[model samples]
Target: MASMSDHELYPIGDAARRSGLSVSAVRFYADAGLIEPTRLNEAGHRMYDIQAIARLELVRTLRELDTDLAEIRRLLDGGTTLHDLLTTHLGIVERQERTLRARRAVLRTLIKQGGTTAQADLMHKLVSMTDEERERTIDDFWTEVGANLDVPDGFVDRLRAMRPVLPADPTAAQLEAWIELADLVSDPAFRGAVRTYLRDTYAAPEARTLATEPFQEFMHGSGAALMEELLAAHRAGESPLSGRVQRTVTLFLEAVTALSGTPLTAEARDRMADGYRQIPGILRQLDEEDAAAGGPGYGDTHGRYLALVAAINGTTGQEHDPIPYVWIADAMQAVQPA
Candidate 1:
């Protein structure tokens, strides 16, 4: 038609130059049926009309958006409606955007902290977890903890609810929190503490008598209070033999009795007293040696221990309080020579 004649035609080489693609790329697109040339010249060169060039530009744009050749072909072939294609691609783009945002936030945090290359590499690794990976990480942690215990009916849901959802554009604090959480879960000492708690709870003759209600209350209340008192005392350079420390221990023991709904017999109470007597020795060990110095080290041991305690007591938000199991294990390890 005369109207088609009005449109300028360019040879494949010229079209490639104008479209910012190589001739081979143009040939590939043509072969893929994405952008066909208008005609073949006398010398057998491909000739593209203005419209074909425009379509080639669109193909380039789609490629930049990471659309695969098959999808592009589907769009060109009308096998897929543009609306459907765009809707699907939108999700992909959004996910990629989230990943990029997380990476950028991590990089900014590292930059602000003047972090080492290793730290930067760690950030990258954390940011690279897919949605499935994140879900699996959370699920695995909860599953391991809940394996032996009679977790309440809605406990799993509650646990999931408590999990912090790291945003696509996470803050530096969130990133740091995630990293710490990851480290806490991954630590052998922490894992061992969790396993020990499971074993003790499952192996106990009074397992059914271990009421979750009282345990939860004690954790949030007196147990947390005791930990706070101990941490404060430890910080204040006060003697473990001090009256204040004794009073705190008594209060903690009374709370444990109240929660368990049983009176502590004189013998049981004496054993508890004996445990208190060992506190100063344990503190001395923690102060004298690093966590790695013995079979159980205190280096990061204290922090890791506290994190476990907080997690179990449901007071994990309380800073610097070690979980009881972790504290005991670390104490035992601290005494053993590496």
Candidate 2:
């Protein structure tokens, strides 16, 4: 064979220069099976054909598109099975393009308005809470609770009923509610309150005691009825300071004692008597004060109290029903210093 110049059959380093790639890069591509040298020289150094140099250029182009090395190898190996990979890459590119377009739209709006830092901050917040992101946040909270508690029967249904579902177009109040609710659930104090409530219901020996069953039934049934009656009186313009109010209160207390398995012991009755003595003086004071001079009417005040109670109790009458009394108590306790 005739002796050829270095240009005719260059070594790996020269091939790299011709291909506009580093020698190390050429070796990596060869090792990755994207390209191979045509022959080896006397010292067993790689000798590349011109065609191999062309293949290196092609590999560099594919890599610039972010194609994986394994996929590159398949393309080089005559694998015509790259349709799925190309489709996936195209979808990703399309999504990125969409995001950029949205960002540009926001910037344009800001520019036209002579944007402030507040607008920029609002944009950041909104972008952070994509629909998918919000759903994942809610799902994560439930998932964590699911791992810890056997969700009581009807609890999930109640949650679905009471939970605020922010509209596709949410108002500022709704957004504020969501932020507060999220914060409440994430707080250790709130969690501790929830744990305590759950423990009281499910773990306490007293809760299972026969004496407690009657009390529970009374609270859920008769006590609820008494509350309804008192509410009705307030609604009817009856003075809560009147003798009628005292009579109703006495009857309600009697009902409680009757419903409880153990009647009020002598000591308890004595304590109750002491409390009763103080009530008449309070009622007299309330009588002397004008109804219009106080805060909201009794009915309105009671309604607000009931709403808070309902939220704490997790009771739901309608979608996004008011908070229960128990929840209000728990939340209040959580916020109180030990």
Candidate 3:
């Protein structure tokens, strides 16, 4: 053809504008062999046709997704499908999102607590630890606690199995939980509490007897439906005090009282309610003066500590709901206690 219509070709500036790239970028892509000038204009200036403009636009989009230049070229050459390119980049973005969220949570915690430089350094280090390091830390914690534990009936084995596994792409809450767990386990007090719990709760004769009670079996049988409903709420991150949770707890308490033939006395119920009310305060009163200041919230019990471990491992299941026992224990002191 002797000449081309204006609509069929674009000047370099026009092509750059249409493709959402700077003039230099369009020229660079051309130099990279990803695109090319269609022809020279009457003034001998490089120009691109409609097809070249479309290719430059695709390059701009892929680059915006953090695609490397080589990958972009592969995509241009039809060496990779668009679906493959997008799928790969989507995974990259998701991983980046988790990393950013973890970093943001760390910064937020520091900001919220007015954390010391040492605290900041520790938080950073804990969040950055390799998987092997995390496992080693957990192992050390268990080793110390295990020395005092005499739990039988596979309890010790199950407890040991619940070590943190921090997921390949952990949620913000999971990352936060792991940080607190790391801090908590590194504290001697927390390890001691675990030992004390194992001795006082699991190894106790009456506690062991209670473990095999008919009601315990009922809980896993008839009560599992209610338990699973509450568990679903927990997994969805619903507040324990929500109306739905209250209803579920009420149902659970009724079932427990009926099955155990132990009507919760009004006094016991009052004590339980008072205990539950104190939980929020107790959780906040954790070792504020130590590295574990943000440690083991939610009643500040080893129960919460274990919950954090379950969270990082993506294995929370059949979690105990403590608030309802408040609706059921009717005891109290001059002040609330954990």
Candidate 1: minimum summed lDDT over ten consecutive residues — where? 329-338
Model 3 per-residue lDDT at 145: 80
Q: lDDT of model 3 at residue 322?
A: 51
Residue-wise lDDT of candidate 3 within 1-338, one digit each (tens)? 43455458788999999999999999998888889899888898988888889889999999899899999888888899999999999999987887798898788778877899999889989998998999899888878887746655545545666678887878877888888899998999888766765575555564564444455556657777776777677667666666676666566655655655766554544544575576566544534422364433234556767788888877777455653333223212111221
User: What shift in Å separates residue 15 of candidate 2 from its native position after superposition?
Assistant: 2.4
Model 3 poorest ten-residue lDDT run: 329-338
Please estimate how well model 3 matches the true structure, expressed as its whole-model Cα lDDT: 0.72
Residue-pair clashes, model 2 = 10
| C-alpha lDDT of residue 76 in model 3 | 82
Residues 1-338, model 2: lDDT tens digits? 54454346679998899888899999987786678887888999999877788788877776777888878887778774557667877888877765564455446555765778887565445434676765665555444443455334444233333333445544333344444454445555554445434433444453343225455556557766665665555556565555554455455556655664445454444444454455556545644452545433322322332343344334425333222323222222222111
Query: Which 10 consecutive residues of model 2 have the lowest summed lDDT?
Result: 329-338
Model 1 lDDT per residue over 1-338, tens place? 46864587899998898788899999999887788899998998899987788778878877888899998888888898878987998899977776666676577767777889998887777666765776676667666665655544444344444554555655445555565565566665665565454443335445433335456556656687776886676567665556666566556666676665766455545555556556677666755653444433333433453443344334546466443433332222222111
> What does each candidate score in C-alpha RMSD?
13.2, 19.1, 9.1
How does candidate 2 fare on TM-score? 0.32
lDDT of each: 0.63, 0.55, 0.72
- Ranking of all candidate structures by their TM-score, best first: 3, 1, 2
Off by over 4 Å in 1: 1-6, 103-173, 177-338
